[model samples]
Target chain A: MDIIVSQLMTGLSIASILMLVALGLAVIYGVTGVINLAHGEFVMLGAYAAWALQTEFGMGLLASLVPIFIIMAAVGWLVEVLVISRLYDRLLDTILATWGIGVMAQQAVRLAAGGELRYVQMPEPLSKSVTILGATDSAYRLFILFVALALFAVTWVIYRHTNFGLKLRAITQNRAVASSYGINASRIYRLTFAYGAGLAGLAGALVSPLKSVSPEMGTNYVVDAFMVVVLGGTQSLMGTLASSGILGELSGYLAFYSNDTIAKALVLLAIVVLIRFRPQGLFTARVRT
Target chain B: MSGKTKTEIVICAAVCLAILLVPVFMNDSFLLNKYARYLVLGMLAIALSLSWGYAGILNLGQATTFGLGSYCMAMALKLKTIPIHTGPDGLPDFMVWNNVPELPWFWKPFYSTTFGVTAGIVIPLLFAALLGWFMFRGRVTGVYAAITTLAAMVVVQLVIIDQQAYTGGFNGITDLAQFDVAGFAFDAYGSASYYLVAICLTASLFLALAVTKSKAGLIVQAIRDQEDRVRFFGYDVALYKIFIFSVSGAIAGLAGMLYTIVMEFASPTFMGVPLSLSVVIWVAVGGRQSLVGAMLGALIVAGMQGALSESETFLDSWTLVMGLLFVLVVLFLPKGIAGAVETITARFERRDPAPAQQPQRTDAAGAGTHHLESLP
Candidate 1:
């Protein structure tokens, strides 16, 4: 019972992180027809932001979130203005352009930070393993779970009930009509991109303690986030949530049964197989074209 | 053929010949060897262009085919170097270190040079054909193809790194014997290796050119321009996709084979995302529509990389420059360097202008004149 509970905790923790990282990708992809290949770099930039704050200002990871989120969001806004703004209509070209931006971000980080791992000090209160539901796990892991749930709730409310959410969804369905309705689609796109970047930044800041922060760290996470987005049916919020849960738990369970590497390989293989069969993914978004 | 395109063809042939004759002017074996590596990589770029530029398929995991091809040759070369003292049935060094008792049965076929060489090319085709079948049958076209291929790359790389005993794990299969063909030795330091690589690259370029210029090539281009329209015309889009993908994979594998000969080892890095993405960068920068341009792009990019990494000041910023170039090309020069050249030449010299969009249907397969018009 202890092992099963611990496994479930592990699964949920990973699922939460995946959800946090993937949420930004889902949001940006949903609002803007452009697929941001630089989404991973935003996550990386966020982690670096947290690291910079922790090391330079002696700030804790928990304290660094708001500032990091703002800064990364600003970066995202600038990126949209400078690069993504021009390439909105060209989907394939956006991939190439954003990918170029991603590479530039990676190289820029490496040039500034050097090719070495940088660690963030885990907070004193959450440093130790604690018992939850009669099973022991890191206290930090539980905090992340809380953050993920809180984030989901926050995002769900912002998009579902808010006027801004309505504007964003309206533009996504029909840009001209939304503009006809007097919605500033471009302005909304900038905010959506920035908010997505901020969310990614928060995911990075939260995740810094779990692993040593590095430039290349975002690459794997971004790919996983992309998988979530692709498998989640690009425009569906609920799909991202459910797919993240399934993929995370499946890999976590598989790891318990066998090795982590094999678990990862099998998960990828399964996703590929699933993608082959269901190209549109699990749930299709209803957009009025 | 227009006088300008004929000049472009002449320029391409001259560049290849000049690279082939590089040893005469340059005494540096290091320079010669580096050029050889560029040509090998250029072969890969050509292979990528055939599918990506012509068929409108962006196979983001091209390194998978390249790596598989290299590994096949590496296994054979590693087998040849296995000492008799380890016994006739003894495994490679890494396998022994990993406590693998004997040679794995699958590797036994790689013991023969003929079989190993054949398998090196054939396996990648089969792998690509199977992947293409799955992708095309599922209608995983456009960006979905890119996503699936990238995922496939990660999976393949992880598998290679995971199975230590079978694949030599992280370090990969190394210290390969010099590549030989029917007792003709290819010493890394010798002139023969360079010629062999150049010959293969030139042949592959022409072969791809032949393919793109054929009636089949027109059909593939039409499919790229309009998939459903061609499907409506009763062509099996899936079969053509698979065929082109397989051919591209075969050429990539052959390039990998040559790469092993020049580089002297094959590692999991060959199949990693960065190298695979690098192939896309090379093809895109050279103008994907032009085979010769793709080749030159690889050559130029590889050359710049070598120079930049060596210089102390530019070392850190070189990749940044590459990234910047990638973005700039996509935005400002979508047609790439070749497109620039074509336009520049067009302004200076006017001729019987070919249709601005698609080339006219040409029945002649080997007409060098037809080659220039069809390429852009």
Candidate 2:
């Protein structure tokens, strides 16, 4: 019973992090119709940003989150204006270009930070453990779960109720019709891309303390996040949440039974098999073209 | 033949001839050895072009086949190495260290040189065929195929790393004996090895070129241009995709075995992400649609890498430079170096009236005829 409770907690924690990462990817890919392979690099850059802020200025990870998000958003904006903006509608070309950007970001970090692993300090107050459902777990893990839920709720409200999101949705449905309605599709795209990138950055910042920060860390995260978004079905926010929960629990349970490596391999194989059956993914909304 | 086809054939012939004659002019064993590795990589680029350029399937896990081939060859060679490197029972050293008392059934077949050679090509071919069957049958195209392949590669890599006893784990298979056939040996630094690589590359180029010119090849190109239309015309699109993917995998496997022979060892990194991405970069730089151009791209980019790594500062920044080049190529040189050459040649040929025989059958015309659909 203890093990089950603890496992459930760990699974939820993992699911929250996966949701955070996949959320940004879903938004970017869903709205823009561009697959940003550099999404992981954005997450990586966020982790680095957190490390720099803490090491250089003694800022706490929690306090540095907003600044890191904004900084990453600006960086994303620049990438959009410079590269992704030009390659719109060219899906394959966009993938290659983003991969190039990812490589450059990784190499640039290696050159700047010297390719060594960096660490981020957890907040002093969140260092304790808490018992939930008769299971003791890290307070920090619970904190991440809280933050993730809060962010998702915030995103849901923005997506469903905000005028900006309405314009973004209009653009997504029909760019020509949306443009005719006086919606600046390009501007919305830029902002949406930036916002999605910023969310990825926040996930990175949150995850930095749990994992060692490195230039190559983004590759793994990107792959995982992609699996989540892909499994959830692109453009489906609710599906991203559900799939992340399913995969997170699946990986957590599998890892508990076997080892981390086997668990990861199994999860990937399962996703591949699932994708083979349903290329549209597990939860695609029914709509007429 | 169209003017473009003529130009491609002439260029391919010149490149093959130049590769064969290099030993005649260059006696430096060190450079000759380096060129041999590049030529083997050139074979890998050709394989990638067949699938990505011709069939329009971007296989991001190409290194999976290459690494599998390398390991197969390495296992066989390891068995033939000096007894000192083996266990008391003559098993590979890593197996002994892991307390594996007997040679596993899988590793046993690799003991025979002929089996190793055949398995190197056949295994990857089968693996790719199985994967391609699932993918194409499921109608997975474009970016989805790329992601699935990438995920599969990572899964394979993780499994290899996890299985320390059979795979040699992270250290990989090393201390292999020289590649030998009966009494004849091909030393790494000798002309024999270089000649073998050169001959294989030339043969592969011809084979690839021949395939590109065949009836099925034309159909494959047509499928790339308009997949649904080809299906409506009663062609089995999935079957052709599977064939090209398997053929490409077989070629990559062969390249991997050659890599193990030339580099003298096989590591898990052989099937790593970086090497796989590098192969794609070479194809992109060379012009993915042209087999000969793709091969040349591999040679040039790999040669540049060798040169860059020779210096400390440049070694660190080489990937950065490559990244920028890839981005620039996508932006301004989408068709790559070969595409540029064709444009220049077409301009010169424009002066002649009716320069081409088949108007609808040119490579560029096919490429320009269709814009790929972005799947939701």
TM-scores of the candidates in the order shown: 0.93, 0.95
Candidate 2 stretches with Cα past 4 Å from truth are A287-289, B1-3, B351-376
| DockQ of each candidate, alpha-carbon based | 0.77, 0.79
Worst 10 residues of 1 chain B by lDDT: B357-366
Chain B TM-score, structure 1: 0.89
- The lDDT values for all models are 0.86, 0.89
Clashing residue pairs in candidate 2, if any? none
Q: Write candidate 1's Cα lDDT for A68-148 as tens digits.
A: 989989999999898888877667788889899999999999999887999888888999899977999998988888988
Which stretches in model 1 have alpha-carbon errors above 4 Å?
A285-289, B1-11, B84-88, B350-376
Tens-digit lDDT track for model 2 on B255-311?
Answer: 999999999999999999888998999999999999988999999999999988989
TM-score of chain B of each: 0.89, 0.93
